[model samples]
Target: MPPVLDEFQGLSAFDAIMRHGNLGAGAEHLGISKSTLSRRISHLEYQLGQPLLHRQANRLIPTEAGTLFHQYCQQMLSLGERSQMALDELREEVSGDLSISVHPHFLRGWFNRLLTEFIEEYPGIRLTLTSNLQPPTREDDQVMLWLWEGPTRDSGLRDEVLGHQRQHLYAHPDYLRQHGHPQHPGELASHDWVNLIDRHHPDLVLHHPEQGEYRVSLPPSRFTVDNVVVHADHITHGAGIGLLPDHHVRTRSVAHPGQFEACLPEWQGPSIPVSLHYPFGHPPRKLGALLDRIRRHVPKDWGQP
Candidate 1:
């Protein structure tokens, strides 16, 4: 093996000189005197046993051998930088602050447990969670969680999808019994509709593998809720028939048996994807660790009914 060389400073000086094409500019850039910069280049050349640079008019030009040596020098400098960054990241992983902006809907389910467990496991991290109904806007330290639908939009932010949230029609047993259970999609129009806020579309669309697509115009709803829990509560309390996420329904069903039952179980509504977003680059070590925890602990079939 080649003898180990501890010449990072000298290598850096040479690289700076080559990049700037002169000793004056390179020394200025490195915040060193011309004499000090010249001494480093001389020492480096003596060790390598060749002239790395020569005067060509006003500028300093590298020789044919110097060109090859400069390439290696650049590689060494880059490796040193990357190595330092890795060490710094390792240090940051142990203790740092992380800011997260999450949609309020995500806090309703297993996400709270996930956050609780993460805080307990990694006490070093200072996690700040903010609630936002809109998509991310800035590229900074904060990581954002928002609802995604269909194919990803051309938003410049990078995202890691956690899971999907699928909606299906649900109603309380009492309401269905009182209003008479509807068998066909067309019969749904006669029943009272409970709409979620922002779902202004007149038609309710559903799809199936064998039966194809189904659409029905919704009548004016008696209740329009912005909060998911409130919306689910209204449906469970026999207020009206409404669309609810499968996961919420499952959790409710397990917690309180027969509270809400699926209506037209064969057909499925639109699927909303949950995604975590950050700026386009490697996330900070603290954020990276949290992301790893989410990926490992968050169940793949989290949204399944």
Candidate 2:
């Protein structure tokens, strides 16, 4: 005799009966008459060489063996569903709606270029992008591009560091000419400053290769902007000296010509980490393809000096 597990229909009947607690409802769920459902369960019991269920007044109660068998049936059904889903993913085309949340600065710069390339690569995938200062919630089915400044705690999400951006002190040429260039990091305190309200600190810190670290007390800013692009714009228009990511300054240089100049060539500012975060499991095929495309197009030294 073959194993009772080979008869999938028998397993379904038993599971439905157990779930509904009555043969009539089970038969309705399976779209079969109660008589036929009864025969399937009877056949299943015969194959196992035991009476699986005891018929009560209004319901079918599982025996000890029946309860154990029901557990196996549930596991089998779950495995089958997962196997079918895996097969479907393999056979299906990579096409779906991919929602992403990204920092506004990236949307304005290198990330936009990567997005164009990604769309060209996968014409079937529709992309929706939102710019936000904070990461998206789990309820939102969206991937996020995040800038991690310090050590990130383990959040059980999938986080892949794409690259790093080096922060540098920059001032517009007009501002530099008017205020005169600071020869050393220590002299930066006297300059008018444009600062990012969220990112900048009250005390400016700089690192020198030979001289080590220098901390300068910052005065009131000439202008403060919350958005990175706007912050860069303020610095480009000679609002004040601002510490900005190198990539942002490079992107801004295209339009502003030679309006921007690095203030302290020898001092290195902090490095900002760029990362991609998504749910911590097997991503859908379309999202996987987009992630691959981004990995290919985005500069390896994204936030480097």
Candidate 3:
């Protein structure tokens, strides 16, 4: 007969210990004590009739069998998470943990305000915002909510087109007033261009509306920056002309007595597609609520309508 292993039967606690590799850390993750966990693992080992882990320097290393068990444990936890997501989806409740990765500029805009309102509406749902561009690490408990820039149909993820990011040419009112705004695209070369030095995609300049796209190769920085928010800051301070996303820069004109114009008509720019991605079927409840709130607030111009 199989021995009793009731205490350490749940996949969650097992996964937590497997993820951390140390007794104290694993116990901390499970909000338990090291001795209690040790007893549980010892019992489980007796039930399986094989050693699952080896001790070294007060740490735990998974035995060969333990490795296979750990893999199955992860899959089990994933299924459990989906089950919880399903129940939440069925209940139509948005109360849990919501995790998402976003562009840095989002923190300064709607994503910021949205959280406040969402919290006020569903205080039970905890929202975690991250700056990750790739998938969240395997051990991360929070579900990933990444910001998108285009139609992503091939990534094997279940994703929805959330919005479209419209970009525009912008400069400080003071700078434009001092140098005068360009009336045509060709004239843009004479003025200083604030380049966001992206290693993957070269700084685009010399736009040809008829052709649809342009990537200009220019020398070192008139104003070279890697962060979009930094570029926004520079433009707000009247540094130089730069390509700014309309989502970040709301203003359109050059200047008024009390206001600053951020973009001009002649140099109108492009739009990037944005989306919300997750695993197949029902996602977490907290994720649904956050997505709903975003969708509710996102304007028709954002591409949903």
Candidate 4:
């Protein structure tokens, strides 16, 4: 007699029991009752005409045959996973659940348009996009997009540099008209500043092609905001002069002309690299398609490499 497809479940149960060295732990891990787990293993033993596991001081120790069989079980399980992956790849259309976590800033301006287009293109795909500040930790999350400050040290994740987010001081035309527009970086000190709540004293390091670096200590912000969109809203609504991403400013300018413009056109802000991280393997078609879509349609002004 040959083992049928259903026997793989028993093989998995046996493997879990062997790996955990107890029925209780294995059952808990598999989300099954101990009795149900015992039945599966007992049935597996019955098929083999021998006892696979013996009780030795609360531990489920595998017999010699069981020990040899466990190794084959591991190989079988690995093959099963590969078979499923192969089937997914061979599908006629890219379709499946794709989950992505991105920084909150990425969700602002123009990103929605890209998302709308992606949904239209891949109607079969079930997509979940989350705005997250923390790094990706969940194994089930297929992709993550975040601001990369420095080199990545996590060996478990595979990452690709998407672009650099360059920021510069911006202010509303109304505010500039009322407060008097600053002609120099030194003149910027007197203006009210809107900043992130996390920053105790946000320093502006402006770089010029000709004038060089000018580090300015920002005055304590009168308006502190936690959200990036709110920060931009305040700046656009005459709250104060604030640093904003170049791409975001451009998008806002196009959407609401003369609402916001750069304080100093020549000087540029620090470029924070945006990276895409995924589990260390060949990404599924859905994830791959989305990545390709982003690369293809990302705004040229976004400063992607």
The 10 consecutive residues of candidate 4 with the worst lDDT sum are: 142-151
Superposed Cα RMSD, model 1: 4.1
lDDT of 1 by residue, 1-305 (tens): 11233449889889898899998999999889999999999998999899989998989999988899888888887777777777667756445666777666766667778878888887887777777666665544345333332345556777677777787889999999899777877888899888887753488788877989888888888988777788888988898888888888887788899989789888788877777666676667766777787778755555632
Give lDDT tens digits, candidate 3, residues 160-265. Answer: 7776766677777788999898766555567777777552124454344565555544434567776677776777677667777765565323233322465455
lDDT of each: 0.77, 0.77, 0.64, 0.76
Tell me the TM-score of each prediction against the true structure: 0.82, 0.69, 0.59, 0.66
| Candidate 3 similarity to native, TM-score | 0.59
Candidate 2's error at 35, in angstroms?
20
Give the TM-score ranking, best first: 1, 2, 4, 3
Residue 168 of model 4 has an lDDT of 81
Query: Per-candidate RMSD vs. true structure?
Result: 4.1, 5.6, 11.9, 8.9
Window of ten residues with lowest summed lDDT in model 2:
142-151
Encode model 4's per-residue lDDT on 8-80: one tens digit a residue: 7788899899889998999998889999999999888888898888999999999999998899989998777
Q: Write the number of the candidate with greater TM-score, choosing between 1 and 4.
A: 1
Clashes of each: 0, 3, 5, 0
Clashes of 1: 0
Query: How would you encode candidate 2's per-residue C-alpha lDDT over 45-157 as one tens digit per residue?
Result: 99999989998999999999999989999999777666666766777787777777776666666777777877887788787887766654455544533333333455556
Which pairs clash in model 1? Answer: none
